[model samples]
Target: MSPTQASRPSTGRAARPLAALLLVAGAAHFARPRTFDAIVPRSLPGTPRAWTYASGVAELALGAAVAAPRTRRLGALAAAGFFVAVLPANVKMAADWRHRPTPYKEIAWARVPLQLPLVWWAMRAGRKV
Candidate 1:
């Protein structure tokens, strides 16, 4: 096989974990929307529910795109951007939970940094494509 082809990840392999993560997270938004709604940054326009559902839809679509080998490159790239875009919501959650119990606050705070690895994974997946 050509060097480029050989270097590429096995078809859909690199993208599968990311795709599954998005799919599950997307489903959670709809399944337990109030949880997601609570984290929507108050600064964003429109109702929290609206933003929650929109993000859920975007996640589902991105997951599907990433699952397909033909679309994995663009999908993974977009997923990286999506990870960055949601930082505000995570920050909002952290700030809002600051007064809560230590465990809750720590969990919320942990999510903020978790985005970095997710972004890195998405970028790596895109490159492997």
Candidate 2:
């Protein structure tokens, strides 16, 4: 194998968890659309519910694509984009949950910085496939 190829992960297992995460997260959108809508940031146009469903669809698509070896690369890139595209929602969640109960409040706020790690994970998955 070429040096570059040798240096890369030898197996596709690295991305499996990421794919599963995308799938579960995507499903949650449909499962409880209202929860997602609550954090849809008023600054954005269109109903928050619409945005929630749209993002959910995107997540499902990305999850399916990334799970297949043939489409992994493109899916990974899309995953990264999706993660970034939803950052505003996370921000809104953090802000709205500020006055919520203890653990709930902290949990919501934690999702804000959590995006950075998620982005890095996406990048890694992208590079692997």
Top TM-score model: 1
Query: Model 2 over residues 1-129: C-alpha lDDT tens digits?
Result: 788887778436656888899999999999999999998889888998998899899989998987888888889888988888888888888888889899998898889788888877777876752
Candidate 1, 1-79: lDDT as tens digits: 8998887676466679999999999999999999999999888999999999999999999999888888898999999
lDDT of each: 0.92, 0.84
Query: How many clashing residue pairs appear in each of the predictions shown?
Result: 0, 0
Give per-model TM-scores.
0.90, 0.89
Per-candidate Cα RMSD to the true structure, in Å, reads 1.9, 1.9
Once fitted onto the true fold, the runs of candidate 1 whose alpha carbons sit more than 4 angstroms away are: 2-11
Give the distance in Å from residue 86's predicted Cα in candidate 1 to where it truly belongs.
0.3
